[model samples]
Target: MILAAGRGMRMRPLTDTTPKPLLQLRGKPLMQWSLEALARGGFDRLVINTAWLGEQIGERFADWPQQHPGADLRFSHEGQDFGYALETAGGISRALPLLGEVFWVLAGDVYAPDFLFSRESVERFVASDRLAHLWLVPNPPHNPRGDFGITADGLALNQAEQKYTYSTIGLYHRALFEQPWCDVVPGNPQGTAVPLAPLLRKAMDAGLVSAELYTGPWTDVGTPERLAELQVD
Candidate 1:
């Protein structure tokens, strides 16, 4: 699932009209880069959660099935159901029906141009006992402190001396968002706003999460300047 619901407060004026994922980057809609990459990676279905000018996102990619023959698109329209975009966990909860027991998640606005969504990686994650597997990236200037710490055993820890940013790309098992950690109530259709980090931290404490450092060209296009730099490249 591509998380395209953020208000994109950081992207400001540019996002004032367009959803950040729909914003053009290097002559293509940013989310399309992920869609194309997923197709190349052997994925066939997609569930995109959208808000903040999300209609455009739907309209723009309405023809994805035609564009990529075998691939299909399904949207979890958060704006219509909840009147706004639910944060990460909420959005995922709302879309759980579309996404089965295990699924892939990626932030729509991030520009990981060379990052390949590996089928082998997904297969490995599914086979493992871990509830979630995240990809971490080196801290960017905008978020210098980073989010989580990676342990020697490849498990994600709540905190550590050397931290890395959550790449917003991961494989998740639906159970993590259900009952014990938080009452996401994925069995229902309604959603509540909730950030994903706390839930991830809760699971990490129990050693249910794993992670890997992605040493690739990753850009968080949080501002117009970063978007422009990417365009220049």
Candidate 2:
């Protein structure tokens, strides 16, 4: 599941018309590169959740490559920051049905290679039964607020350290969202805003979450300068 719908207020002018995922890095659309990587990772079917500028994104994949032929492609349009975007956890919660039991989720704006394997990685973490398994990168200088969890070979945290940070990318199991949920609807009326961080903290305290520090290049392209840096890399 690609988390593609965001206001990208940080990206202002560039994102005025184009959604952040559609913004190009190097020469291709940010998501196109991601799609190519997913293809390499052996992901055929994809469910993208979109809110802002969703039409153009849908159009780009209309003629999407044949590399992953017979690939089932579906788009869940969440065009409403006021009408459909369910924040982070809220968005996933609403789309859980479409995502199936355990699913891989990534932010559409990030461009990384070999992020997912050529085939599905071992289904190690249980979403319905256990805490989600997150792929975390070392806390970058920009985001000093590091989120971390140390467990006995599990994604569940043991030590209650508030210093380490969490990564935005993860493979989620769907049950930690059962209680203490957030607002899910417009105006957040009957809404759910279950952000991943606090949830991780809760699960960590229970020794239900696990983490792996990614030693690869993962950039949070929230700013134009970072986006520009990504473009040249």
Which prediction has the highest TM-score against the true structure?
1
Tell me the tens digit of each residue's lDDT in model 1 across 58-159: 999999999889888999989977789889999998888888888999999888877888889988988999989999999999889999999988999887
| Model 1 backbone overlap count | 0
Give the per-residue Cα lDDT of candidate 2 at 190.
49
CA shift at 43, candidate 2, in angstroms? 1.6
Q: Each model's C-alpha lDDT?
A: 0.89, 0.69
Write down the TM-score for model 1. Answer: 0.97
User: In candidate 2, which residue ranges exceed 4 Å CA deviation?
Assistant: 65-67, 80-84, 118-120, 126-129, 152-164, 179-194
lDDT tens digits, residues 200-232, model 2?
677767666666767777777788999988766
- Measured against the true structure, the TM-scores of the candidates, in listed sequence, are 0.97, 0.84
The 10-residue segment of model 2 with minimum total lDDT is: 180-189
Q: Which pairs of residues clash in candidate 1, taking residues 3 or more apart in a chain or in different chains?
A: none
